[model samples]
Target: MGYHVVAMPYPGRGHINPLLNLSYLLVSKDDITVTFVLTEEWLALIGPVSGAPNIRLLSIPNVVPSERTRSADFIGFLNAVFTKMEAPFDRLLDQLGLPVSCIVADTFLPWMTTVGSRRNIPVVSLWTMAPSMFSVHYYFDLLAAHGHSPDDNLPERREEIIDYLPGVSSMRVADLPYPTVGRGGSTRKHVIEAFSVITKAQAILFTSFYELQPHVLNTLRANLPVPIYAAGPSIPFLSLKVPPSKPIASGAAAYFDWLDSQPEASVLYVSLGSFLSTSMEQMQELSMGLKASSVRYLWITRSEASSLQEACGEMGLIVPWCDQLKVLCHSSVAGFLTHCGWNSTMESIYAGVPMLTFPLFVDQYHNSKLIVEDWGIGLKLKQRVGEEYVIGREEIAETVKRLMDLNGNEGRELRKRAKELQETCQRAIKLGGSTDNNLNAFVRDVVQGQCNFAN
Candidate 1:
């Protein structure tokens, strides 16, 4: 047998999707047996797929469905995972038929790392977010240490710019994903709990390409106690090797067909990821905006209108869920209207598609800032309604028109820069590249018992 690699991810679609792709890569190598632990609700949502024989899907007790309507409570979820899920996971490791070699878990799930340390099994923390975002979270302790929290209010602090995150230009405190830094209570406690785990992990696996975050990665290596591995462009790694048996469903065909029909460098691709739900008003605005722009677009939206042909009456296409990578690779996709999610950002860069960024919650707003203000390959649309940063349909329409103007000359130049980024991403993932080397070194230094640290 080979190494037994176990992966535990958070219950969200954004986190689970990337980890699953990485597991597939490990399983294909023939030297890994992957035991993927999912929340019970997540497992039920995905149903089943014929994956690698060595890869097994196990369910843990996060019994609550992610969709349950409730006030967003940060502490409630954290405490539940720590108090309940921890013991069963430890038992799962103990009962495994194969000797467990290492556990790779999301950095947000601290209890798993704690269990790994206690059992003497190596644990590698996987970060699905960008390294810049990780750096901010890692340094949050500094804010609290300086009496910045509780004493001062969040809205007051959020106006201050954060200049410390590596490779990042000066970012507003509001740009930091955890915008509630100085606010007391569950949100603050949750941030502290997550950051505490960073120092405890033997190694940290960041899902990013080195070229995309060179200075940030450098800063992380010099400052952090644990090894940091930048192993990414992981999604494209999956796109190149899908098997025949696991065919992409025909339901995704309308988007592809529309993609096929457009002139080269003429279409825009838009999606808000799986987890986000736009207001009906917002959806109608976006639909109208696409029509007003008069550019070919293939949008992946989850709606009853089943297919793109059904959804777009005359203007563009809208499919429930399309093969995003395939659509991005199509020559017709000149611009991307994105939510600036890390995974979507990487995918856009890998496809060399320039973006019109409309970032929403979490780290997305920051990611959008980097791509637009720092990297210059994308543009950020300003909010229309108020200084409060609430964007509306008018902003969406204007941004799309701006990108598609002059037959997309501006979008094309941005695409050229994006292609350069694509090359950088590819180089980092290849043999002897920064990302590949980092993954190997991280395993040896942490997962292979090369380091001894007390928790």
Candidate 2:
């Protein structure tokens, strides 16, 4: 039998999608077999997702919360992830037919490190976010010692420049992950706990390519005890090269037909992820702003799409959902208005689309800072009012115009720089590229049952 690599993705779309993509890459080699383990409920949730013939799908009981109700009590759900699921996952690992090579697990499940210890299997922690964000979590103790950690009663500060974190660029305190801006301490504690135990893993992996953040990767290599690799751009990018005969999402044909009529680089693609959403007032303002901007747009938001369509009719198309990466790659799509989730950010970079960032939760604010300050390929959109942050329709309209103006120098610079980053990312996935090399090295190390190589 080939080397048996088992994967345990955190049960969320954002985490599961990239883990599966990496699994697919591993299974491409005929000498490798990947058994992807998930909760029985999750297998049913994401029905019939594609996989290679050597990749196996197995499930444990639904030990955690359901996907539909996770958001209602996310803290409780997080508690369950950290506490309840490990036993079932441990039992399932033994029932597999072959001897396991190593476990490639989501970084959020620190308990997996312990499970690997007891079972004598090396575990590679896969962090499915930007390496820059990883540094934020890795060095969170420094943030807490310096009074930057979130406290429910603490006053929010925006101007404090944190230049001390190794490899991370200097940015205002507000641009740190949303949790640091005095949100809640429950999730913040869980976040810190997740990264704390990663030293026990055989190595760590980022869903980012090296060229995207070289300094951060270098500094992490120096400070971290375990080996680290950038085996990524880990979206379903390989599939993008194959042209589709029909649209992937429902009613996708109509919108794609609309795209065929629009001029190149004319439409803005918008999606504020499904996990979190804007308030009704904010959504209404956004819809009206799109109408006022007079720029063509294709918006993919789930909530209140009918109402938003009414507000944003003549100049825009609002759909419940579509193939996001496919839509970003469309000829007419010039820019993205996004929640700055890392998956969406990587997809936009791969598609060469500039961004107008409106971050909602953890890591997203940091991702926005990378796009706007470090990368220079996007503009940020958040207006502060006393203790609250709100974006008025006029502000949204003006920023949209600024980003969509093909004739303007600033807009042209954004597009030019976006294409440059896009090329860098594309090259990283090619043969002998950074991502490919790292992935190959990772496989070699796993087969040897060690993590002592440099990237």
Q: What lDDT is reached at residue 359 by model 2? A: 87
lDDT leader? 2
Candidate 1 local lDDT, residue 266 = 82
Per-residue lDDT tens digits for candidate 1, residues 168-225, read 5677655666332221244556657877767787788888888787889888889888
Whole-model lDDT per candidate: 0.72, 0.85
TM-score of each: 0.88, 0.95
Error of 1 at 118 (Å): 2.1
In the range 1-455, model 2's lDDT, one tens digit per residue, is: 57989899998989998999898888876588888989999888766646478888899899999998887778888888989989999898879979998899999998998988888888999999899889988998888788887442134566777899999989777777765322223688788788879888988989999999999999999999888889888888877767776664346347887787899999999888988777888888888888899999999887887877878878888887677888899899999999889999999999999999988877787888899989999998863322156688999999999999999999999999999999999999999999999989888887456555221
Q: Report the Cα RMSD per candidate.
A: 3.6, 2.6
Best by TM-score: 2
